[model samples]
Target: MDIRQYLDSTYLKTAQQAGLSDAENVEVVKAAVAEAIEENFKLIMIRPDMVAIAKQMINDAKSHVLVGTVIDFPEGKSPLEEKLAEAEKAIAEGADDLDFVIDYTAFKAGNIAEVKQQVVACTRLGRKHGKIVKWIIETAALDDHEIVQLSALIKNCVITHLCEDDYNHVFVKSSTGFYKTENGKPNGATVAAIKLMLENSFPLPVKASGGVRSYEEAVEMIQLGVKRIGTSSAKAIAAGEAASGGY
Candidate 1:
């Protein structure tokens, strides 16, 4: 199926999370960027701090792999100004895509106005800078109804506040690949959740991320109408092997 084009090979672990020293963790990110270039994946998703290094590596290799970085990362609790500043820094560092974690906690808490403001401001910044923007809604942290509402919320915000052309550049991504669920539940993209996102966020595109570890799973998400699949197992999935990992 030539799945490489649909994959955003990702590595977002911090040194502490990976149980490695700072230098060792950077090595991990370097290896991932190297692998993405070698495998010809569509993009390499890394932390904001790693964006410049990854960009340098890709440029030196003369590869086409775009560099993507997370904004406010796995936690989307940052204030609006902070999120904007982080994203601006990432853009200056040569990131091609900006994946912002939407303030799902605030949304769940009924602070819809604040959430909308962040979405509009961040999406506008990305569009202005000519970067692809994706909003990570952290679906696992939300119920089914919240998923639909949040997806629709992003769509409406884009369509109403931004131009029609921005729809293609912005996406409603499924997760941050870091949410913890109760009772051992799946913490990433599920078919039902992806479906809800796709149905509600139509025309804006959906990215099924988190916990997608196999070729079969990636294909399933594609069939359900996702534009991209974010996973740490992109290489294995591309080879038609089942990958074992959390992200």
Candidate 2:
């Protein structure tokens, strides 16, 4: 299979997170953008701050790789206005996809209204601008039931409040690949979580992120109905080799 097209080649680390200087981190992001262009991956997922850089690089290269950026990132605790503001800036910076980290912690805290409000607002904001929107639930932090509930929640929010055309534009994504779980458990996408998402978020599509580090794993996620696979190891996975990376 042409696995590269299904991959969202990703690099979301900050300077401090990667233990590098700001300039050095930008260099790393530049390298990743170049690699995605060379490999012809579907998109390059990055932090919002790097959206302009990635967009400029891809445009200069005349490559078709789309630029995606995170909104609210690993922590989705930001207020709805803050999330929308970040997304607006990313869109202005030429981001093609806006992956917003859903307020999963709020959802877990029985703040369903907060979660639902942001989901609808963010999804509409991205879709209104013709940008793809993916809601990352940080699945590793939740139980199986929460995964299913949250997936259904997103699906319902789109279908109930948005137009039918928006359904295909919005996605229920699996993880951020940055969540730290107890006892070193897998902090990214798992078969169980993906299955729950797929089962609950049908017609809206699902993107499996995190913990998928090999070509086999990518293919497996596709086989299970994921429309996209986000990973830092997209290059190695495309080569059919096992990749070594935290994501």
Candidate 3:
């Protein structure tokens, strides 16, 4: 993807290095994100815990970088109210975008109605705040049919409401860094799901995440039509430094 077109300088829980307290972790994340911006990163996805700090960092920076926050994070089982609260809080903290993890449990259990309801709630809330919402489907856990169904649902919600155009607002992301295949790669199912989103002309972008750590893989994802990316390896890629030992 050429690194800049679709990169969310991500700092998920899994991306945290070991042995740092929450405050220290926030500092580390801020430094990393600052570096990412200096290198021309377009987006920065910060954990909710780090939202306030991230916002401050972005404000102090000389360049403009889109700031985002994750809602319902790795596990999407939080109550709808909680998810909405998190989204609102993030927006209030100056996040320009919201990356919400869809309720994978409900979707996997075939509770289609509940799944849509949760996503719709977050999407509507994001709209109210004038913030872009990117639904993280955790596609690694979904079968092909479910992935297609989710894509269709997002399209319906966003298009029916006449939200912002594709490039300007909203997106469907593929994972939450919770699962990977046996080969230590991000589950292929997530990539497949993103591909489905692309083929269907969904009005939102697609963010590929979880286990994306190298330049080759990043380029491959962009080639696959991923418009956004969530990765902790942004600094290395920007510096043209390959992942240690070829990843």
Highest-lDDT candidate: 1
Give one digit per residue, the lDDT tens place, for model 2 in 11-112: 999999999999999999999999999999999999999999999999999999999999998889999999999999999999999999998999999999
Worst 10 residues of 2 by lDDT: 238-247
| Cα-lDDT of candidate 1 | 0.95
Q: Give lDDT per model, in order.
A: 0.95, 0.94, 0.74
**Which parts of model 3 have CA positions greater than 4 angstroms off?**
14-17, 164-168, 180-185, 188-191, 244-247
Cα lDDT of model 3 by residue, 109-177, tens digit = 878788778877778888777787888877777777778888778777677665455334778877877
Q: TM-score ranking from best to worst?
A: 1, 2, 3
- Candidate 1 stretches with Cα past 4 Å from truth are none
**Which has the better lDDT: candidate 2, or candidate 3?**
2
Compared with the true structure, what per-residue lDDT tens digits does model 1 show for residues 58-122? 99999999999999988899999999999999999999999999999999999999999999999
For each of the candidates, the C-alpha root-mean-square deviation to the true structure, in angstroms, is: 0.7, 0.7, 2.9
